[model samples]
Target: MSALPMLHRAVLAACLLSSIVAGCARKADLVITGGMVWTGLSSGRAQPGAVAIGRGRILAVGDSAAVAPYVGSRTRVLTAGGGLVMPGFVDGHTHFIDGGFQLASIDLRTAATPQEFIRRIAEYAQHLKPGQWITGGDWDHTLWKGAPLPRKDWIDSATPSNPVFVTRLDGHEALANSAAFRAANVSKDTPTPPGGEILRDPRTGEPQGIVKDQALGLVERAIPPPPPAERDSALARALAHAAALGVTATAHMNASWADFASYRRMERAGRMTLRVVLYLPLEQWRDIADTIRRQGQGDDWVRIGGCKGFMDGSAGSRTAYFFQPYADSAGYYGLLQHPEASMRAWIGAADSADLQVTVHAIGDRSNAMLLSIYDSVARAHGARDRRFRIEHAQHLRPEDMPAFGERGVIPSMQPYHAIDDGRWVEQRIGPERIRTTYAFRRLLDTGAKLAFGSDWTVAPLDPLLGVYAAVTRRTLDGKHPDGWVPEQKVTVAEALRAYTWG
Candidate 1:
């Protein structure tokens, strides 16, 4: 044969082989292209990238050209349009159902004055039938001068027909109107509950209708629980809101068994769009363990193998069990929700059951105590991937800072609280101790795992706002342009890592 004919034959054979390979390539169910794709891995990002999905799992992720083979006539295509294509956010802690209700209830978070707070509640109450309990205001009294906690008298007249028991923005305290107090039978003679307080008038000795910590339950118990329909609606609303904000999963703190049932119902009904990890109250650990034993820890969409407990209250409410008295409240050390002995026992039991335990520790004393408890529990259990966490590890003593990493504890913190509380935290704890408040950088530097959250319903649910707070530490009051406790401000990269991967 001639040399030219032989070369032409070789070229044709190569073309046929390429065609055969292309014909055998499987098509993807969906193809997402044209964006900056962050793989959430060490390989870094892929610019102008594409992702192919099939059978509800990612099949390929790389530059657009690399994924082109997966696209077929039946494949659904989505263009990112130069936007970011990253892993969906995972909110480490939330009161998911409560946040859903808050989204639908009157928003008093923006009420800047006493009159505005009353007006908003009154207007919201007007829509309800007489005797309907109004809840979920999430009011922020700090916006007002002096930041005086609201009293019953402030909204008594406005809420004459309805009982009003609205929570403070931190969810650690609540203000009840006269109607609410009357319904709860709260009186000046009523004894304060352990680990709680009922703020009273100084001279008159009358109950001011401001309840802190566990005392909020006094008024809360008097209010009727929302109907099943309302509960379902709240969960649905929250899920939609989370999806819109790019939150793919949330570890719901203080979840009830009812919440778990609702989540499972949603999953079965094909209404669930986001993943949920439920941490029931520590008191229910046995029930949770039994349930887990029977059903097993759930799939990727729903998990139920964690217990949440409170060591103390929050800083804003001044019940955050502290080693020393609060600067504003002379001789008054905050209250501990659980006795040291009881807390240790519960934690040990949970650890033995192989359940993850995360406790809320907002004060230096509480954080230190919980850390000690965790260390003791770890020693007893031997080495394991316990991953015990401290929720709202907000205030810490300088000496206790190293214990987090040393003890293999995760600091599940909310960054927005730093900026939100910065507006008035100094008034509660004073200047020197405020240095370690919301110590994100310090915690990270100590080698503690960082799991960021929004504490939605107490603060905004938007993770972007959380990132801003983490990176800037700018007070919501607009007083600190350079950043509040600027020393604690983390780099944007660090903040993003906490939100996404940590």
Candidate 2:
């Protein structure tokens, strides 16, 4: 099944409804039958049906009788056995290249203890050449007994010879072993990058190994990038993994120029299996816009024209800027990834150049500020069709919630984070603030353009997992059986639209 772009996938049955009634002359390349076919229509209805696909496009979609005209002797028939035949999922957010590399790098997302986390890295390093950097361990410290952040000393003995910068699943923070600090020339004296923080031991003022938000770049610069061959291998694994999970395309949250080159190489070779829409960094808006104009927007296979910026860190990292202080820690808000003034200027210019702007805003304050800036910029510029998006609109103030739809801002969200985060979100913020967290049903009801994704490399890339979380809202810890923030749970069809459409 080809997972093409969503706008093209819109109205799955429109083609058949309009033209297939008279039937076509050519036989279908493939026919899917014996299933509840979801038309992915605005009506949000499904029925027993069949579909015919040919030449990389949806040929005819409807009941078996409606599709029989296109199926012939050579046409392939796929019986769903009463399963679902819906449009392929288009993940709204992801870190594609990182996800690809993480496929073979390490498995730390499930490391239940600090000891297990260090042990996994040590075990993986045993096979690597000495001094080689270890990257891409999406570990979640929250799963540990006390939910303590991992420190350098805990892993230094295990990884004495290797440099390590294992990221938390949220992508907002990382744990760097001692070797990595030396490699990056970081010291107790090194000033934290603007909009970033270095967690340090109080008395000695020594680094404790946790680097949040922008500070992650400090160690990242020292890590040698994967060679072209290794990148190709990673891409191969990523495409296969995505296809296996029924993901047809992605709106890559934070991609790079190097990553774009790799995608182009694959596209030119006709091996690009997954459709990717890359949102390069927002800081380099000039280069991003210039490149798009010089090369022309790519085809359905790969595309460019968007830039992603970050407003604040993630909630799990305690760096997602909020209206109030964290319940557990007083007088501390989240870290901002970019200054508000800089963000405003960059977004305005990018929009003027016709570049789509989607930014990361996980905290309530950041989300509110982002909405204001986007609204101001759109008004000042006298917009044509600027589809501003708030990536990870994770938290919201009730008053600011309806502005998303009123201003036509797209809430590009990840549903899986709700259930996973719900496991301990109340510990970070009080119960009152939890109501609007991942407000899926509320946003949809108010007419916001809610687009859902997995935030791959941070969360599972599986759309079904996201769907289950959205529909069920059951926390992973088994608490809140009725659903975590149950009022936010949406219907199956709404989740499908966010996955398949915008």
Most accurate candidate by TM-score: 2
lDDT of 2 by residue, 1-502 (tens): 1123543754454665846544577688999999988866757888788888876678787777778888889999999999988878889888987888998888899999888887888888899888998888889988999898989998898788899998988888999989999999998998989989999988887789999989999999999988887887788899999999999889876788888888888888899888898889998899988888898878888888489999999889999999899999998887888889999999999988888898999899999999999999999989577788899898999999999899999998999999999999999988999999999999988889788899998899999999999999999999889999899999988888888876
Hey, what RMSD does candidate 1 come out at? 9.3
TM-score of 2: 0.95
Q: Ten consecutive residues with minimal summed lDDT in candidate 1? A: 1-10
Question: How far in Å is the alpha carbon of 165 misplaced in model 2?
Answer: 0.9
Instruction: State the lDDT at 298 in candidate 1.
Output: 91
lDDT (0 to 1) per candidate: 0.83, 0.87
Model 1 lDDT per residue over 91-138, tens place:
888999999988888889899998898788878877899898888888
- Candidate 2 Cα deviation (angstroms), residue 460: 0.8
Compute each candidate's TM-score over C-alphas: 0.91, 0.95
RMSD values for the candidates in order, in angstroms, are 9.3, 2.2
Q: Which candidate tops lDDT?
A: 2
